[model samples]
Target: MPPLSTAATPPPALRQIGAWIAGLRRADIPEPVATVVSGCIADTLGVALAGARASAGRLVAADARDTYADGPATLLAGGRLCPEGAAFANVAAAHALDFDDNCYAGFVHGSAVVVPAALAAVEAAGGSGSDLLTAVTAGTEAQYVLADAVGNGVYHAGWWTTALFGAVGAAAAAAKAGGLTEAATADALAFALCGTGGLRACFGTDAKPLLAAQAAAGGVRATRLAARGLEVPHGVIEDPRGFARLMAAGAFDGQVPATLGRYWRLLDPGIDTKAYPVCLSAHAALDAVRDLMAEERLSEADIATVRCRVPPVVAANLTYDRPVTPAEARFSLPFAVACAMRYGTLGLEHLDEAVLADPSLGAAMGRVAMAADPGWNDDPERARRAPEGAEVTVVTLRGDSFTRFCAMPRGSAARPLAAAEHAAKFRACAVLAADRVPGPAEADRLYGRLRSLDRLPTLDGLLTP
Candidate 1:
């Protein structure tokens, strides 16, 4: 980067995004958008509390402690490290269970990366709560905007968009938190995109969340590099060999969302806060199965076969007919349907290794036949109760078949979880890490701080006294 704005090095599209990140403010953000963002922050922290105990979280926290040594940022779940290291650990923990807030338009886990990255950046600079909140909104906007800027080919092609666009978002948030101008922010964005790209194959492994963690750390590091006046290509996003061309293979045509700031992407085609712990591809199927089982009062023994109709893309992800591990089961539609039929629901409780290892689960998995349903979107929220999204046809031992269509899974924009429900989830997550997390009293205080974030002075109260 030549320092200051490089003239015409990047196409107008990338520069346009840069200007917006430079100008984002708590005042400019609409009330509804800010409110939604607060919920996202609370939800992400809730998930991270639980994730901190997961293998990915524990392993990364150890690395941050051993390698990072001393720093100014807290990991939220526990421990402290350098800002980037904290972000790496925190983001990984947030995504440990794949339950973080999601953006359907971008098809990425937005909150997992944004919250961790922004929190680390803000706390490191001793920034105010408004600064932290603003950083998150800017970061989310950048992620989705870049996701939209790049054609959907990368996602439909099965490359993880969260890892790809999320890095750029992380960089934007860090740049803002670090008080960079437009030129430095652009350079940071350029640096961040260099680390973009991850695989869907890592979905069930510890590697999946680590990929997200890497992106988070990469964002913070990119901003630091920019602030130190390190040199990166200016406006490399739309260059011949830049991010858009290199990442999209020339499919990206420089088109931008018409309403970048006029309307928050968080609201329109909104974020799908997951109700189920499984992959979003299978949430609709799981919802359908649970509803049918509850209505007919069917027992596991009574369930003969479940024919699940999803889009072809959805079926490709839920390929594990009889998953042998908890990770595999998390992506298995057959497994989700089986669990729903067996327990009348699927949740964190049913996703444990002990539950997955049961021999009886294999039989339940066999009875679920997942096929592609045309004329329907993969996302349940778009189903709009039109009976076109995901349908479950269950056959019982009595040879009677009961069918039902799920419009959308709960916790979606169409039927968002209330603030109390969101708090309930936070409490549940805190309970999982009770040994490390604050007690009920302190946790509630922290939550209240987030809800009225604009009034808080600094992020010192995010997790600590």
Candidate 2:
């Protein structure tokens, strides 16, 4: 169903999110909200360490180092930079592999924008871990409310939600951490929203994740400018040419009155952590096929064809039937599903350069077909509840067909990974991230630090050599 049109009734306070964040406090966040904040920070930092090795990560770090001198914020694998510059590099690393956590309702990568911007602000202001948590929670909630209010129309129309709407959340985080007044925080958000947007067409290139990096950096800068007396239009969100009107292509839902802080989007319509670094859209198909392969002992040789029935939203992204590059493969159902069928799993190794040239893998990719299932989304609310739904069927050379329906992806809130499993995943990524792998003792220590970040006096120790 289409979102409520702009003709719908809306109150004057439609874009009051900044004012809301300006009023939030550490004590205001629920314990569950704080827990999600900690989990997001821990997960983002882990992925960023691994992602910092990617080409885009290196480029952003190099640029920041060349452009800005040392400062309070840590730049992950690289040396220090000014807070804004550091935010740019760190955000790049966090999103480099598209491995960061994401919320389905918000339609944004929550931590990719919030953590980098809030962390920079926290370090610059000498805030406590609780301060950091409060800032992140506020900022993430800002984006969630705004995105939900913006409706799903913008996302379906190909606007990159994180890149476009992420700055508003970033501004909220920075303002909260830096002690901006509610009015000033509101001003910062105005400037931030004005800088919105990125296109989904950039998905198969280095530009895709870099958009996230830009949003984080831009948000920090906007907050700083606002602190320095930058005044922007207060009602920009609801103005005739304003955010919801123009950016959303006039398909605004204007549900802010009903949504803002009434219930936490973080707890209710929670985010999903990834088991595979590929697109979330492909996870259900991959999971279904991988399970069938494991249970039946099916190999690439025995498999003749694989069919995946997915909703139109997911079908839109599974375009590359036979991906020729790692970037493309990350969004390809054929690549993820076929490889999982052939190898019985898809892991970090699948992202290596060798997978791109493997003829056997290419042959398997040829056997996988993805089709849009209108019936899959017949009940839109039900589809939204289990967004990863997929009907997967695998045919063998012996004319046998095995089918399974997957409604949830692994690492989702409903089907969460074990705590030990989550830590093991961090280790796997970290081993490839740094020049010297942390010893088991060091790894354990770091994990403890992340878990207790709300009490840490300073974040300075996290990235020091």
Candidate 3:
């Protein structure tokens, strides 16, 4: 890898992305984009703090602590590790509850991986808050641009695009945070893509979030190696036998990189901030059910049947009709709709074993059903427009009907959560880690710091009390 922008090796597409990353500055980002990036970083940190006590989070944090030497990067759970190790553990915690921000760009949980990686790399480099924001933008843009170029064919092909593309995004963010030049940044991208791939089978299990950990850590390692002048294979993404061809089934477009800085994908397709902890595939349906019940003033006892009309992709991903575990419940549309009918909301508390074993919840799940709209097959564009959207119909035991269609869930870009709502969520999630943060007051303090992350001179004491 070159120390400066020589661009002697990578193909045009990869080099174009590298040049964008190298040239990105704090001022180059539009205020709106930077605002969204800041919100996502704060949200990811909040969720990570909450998820630290989850089974997956606990296991990964322990593995990282035991395996890697201590260093400067702070884990959102607690303690410090080397940048790579910290990223590995923190990203897992961010994703363990499936509460992290999602993007249709690559159908990825973008911040769950990118934020932790950027946070670790920037802190390790002693970079400022502005540097962290700039690094996140660079990373998110590169990943989303590539996702646009490749389309969602790989996702439809059952590859976990979060892992496949997130690794590349993590590399971009880490490289930017570490101040790598264009050539070295391109090499980082290449090395990341060379080893990028994951299975969708990990869904509804601990493996899902752990794969996020692998991507985050792998990306940081790739950047560190590139910064050390490692000679990397160039054009790994566009190579005939490489990422695009193999992972995306030859679904590659050459024009997406040209519009990099000229257009920002983050503000357009935007991020989907989840309101519910369940799979995003189930959120639209959950929103619809919540609305129908509240509007009609119907209890779970009054509901005879609840039917969810969803896109084929949603139907495909949410296969757990009768979930017996919390992990499984996150992907279960029945569990999600039932929770909506019973409580009008889904929270981290609903994922507890006692809640999962509740017979009332089980009966409610039995009343809910989901099916794919065959019309989506005929009108592919409609499905593409609202891939995770749903139309729901609720029938009362008294023979009355109430129906609602939600094109997007509440926390989505079209209907963003209020700033106060973000703070409320942060407080709620933070209180879950009682062993790490002392009490509600401390969580509020941390929340304030995260929301004003751009003001911090360094991240050294940001997470500490």
Candidate 4:
């Protein structure tokens, strides 16, 4: 085979990104942006602690202990490993429950992947809270901006954006925290993009969070390698045989990258905190279902049938109608809707075997039917406005039907959760891993530390058992 051609100079977008990543500081981050990122960090760590109590989380943590040599980076579950290993284990745990935050830029689980990588890198480098905040900002913007540049076509094309673009984002975090230069940071991103990819087919399986963890770990590895003078093609994102062409199907927007620092995607199309542990696609419907149930005071026996009209993406992601496992239930609209109808709310506790085997829940799941909204694609503006929105209808046994539409769920950026609600979520998750922590008081202390991440001098003992 002939020698492969390489870009003689870095793309303008890549060069700009490198400069931004190299110069980003906590002081430069906007107050609002810092607050949003801090919330994501707090939420991610809280869920990661709970996730460690999960089977997948426990297995991954164990593997990290056995496979990676000990290092300074601390796992949220409890213990130390190399930065890459720690990032991998912690991220897996954070996402194992599908409760982490989401971003619409690429329809990716941004913080679940970015925050853990930033934490691991900062801890390994003995960096301060400010460093962690800056690293997270850098990583989040890098991934979201790149996703914006390519649009969501890649995601619609059956690619898992969290794993595809998350590696590059994670690398940006690691590089920023490690104090790598602009050029090296750019190279690290390129290496990460070149090395990472995942299929959407992994959505309902353990592979989903496992690939997320692997992407994060790969990113940390890429940054360390680049810091040690490793170099890769700089314009790989726009190269003919590179990311855009191979992954995005040649759907590249050249202008999106130029808006990197000026347009903070993290704030505008902001982070979405998930109130439910299930797929984000199901949140809107669940919100609507619960609302209708409360308004009508309809018990499970009062509902006769239910139908949900959702955007194509929602219908596509929530594929399991009669889920048998916890993983499947997280991706199943039927399970989420059924649980909501039966209990008025769905939480981590509802994933227990006893809950899953409930005859009423199974019957309720059977009653729930999800179909793609015919008009979803007809109106470009509506589709853009609510890509994952849902219209839910509940029919009572008395032959009366009520319909509710939810453009966005409660924890979404448009309708954010209150501080108290966020805290409640954190405490709930922390309690799940009570055996690892002292008690509710320690969990509360940790919550305070995580929320004030920007003020902490170091992450040395913040997540310690």
Winner by lDDT: 4
Per-residue lDDT of 393-431 in model 4, one digit per residue for the tens?
Answer: 999999999999998998999899999899889988998
**Model 4 bad stretches (over 4 Å):** 1-10
Residue-by-residue lDDT tens digits, candidate 2, 1-465:
223336456543423676678777777888888887888887887788888888888988988898877998888865667889888898999888888888876568889888988888898998888888989998888888778767778888888898987888788899999888877887888898887788888886789778998998888889999999998887788789888788787765565534566578888678788888888889988999888888998877889999988888888766777778788888899989877866777887887678868988888888999999878768977676767678999999999999998888898877887888778776776666555345555555676687788778777685422
Runs in model 3 deviating more than 4 A are 1-11
For model 2, the superposed segments whose C-alpha errors exceed 4 Å read 1-15, 255-258
Q: Please, what are the lDDT tens digits per residue for candidate 3 over residues 104-131?
A: 8879888889999999999999998888
Q: Could you tell me the TM-score of candidate 1?
A: 0.92
- How much is 395 displaced in model 2, in angstroms? 0.9
lDDT of model 1, residue 389: 46
Candidate 4: residue pairs that collide = none
lDDT of model 4 at residue 102? 94
Better of 1 and 4 by lDDT: 4
lDDT of 1 by residue, 1-465 (tens): 012233433355546666788888789999889988888888898789888987788998888777765688887556678889999999999998877887865678999999999998898899988998899999998888778667567876788889988888899989889888877887788788876788877877788899999998888899899899966775576678777677677665454533468757788667778777778888877888788778888888998899987766687666677777777887888888888878777777887889888888878888889887665654554543432247789999899999987766778776788778777777767667776654776666667777788888977756741
Q: How far does residue 12 in candidate 3 sit from its true spot (Å)?
A: 2.8
lDDT of each: 0.79, 0.81, 0.87, 0.89
Q: Any residue pairs clashing in model 1, and if so which?
A: 1-231, 1-232
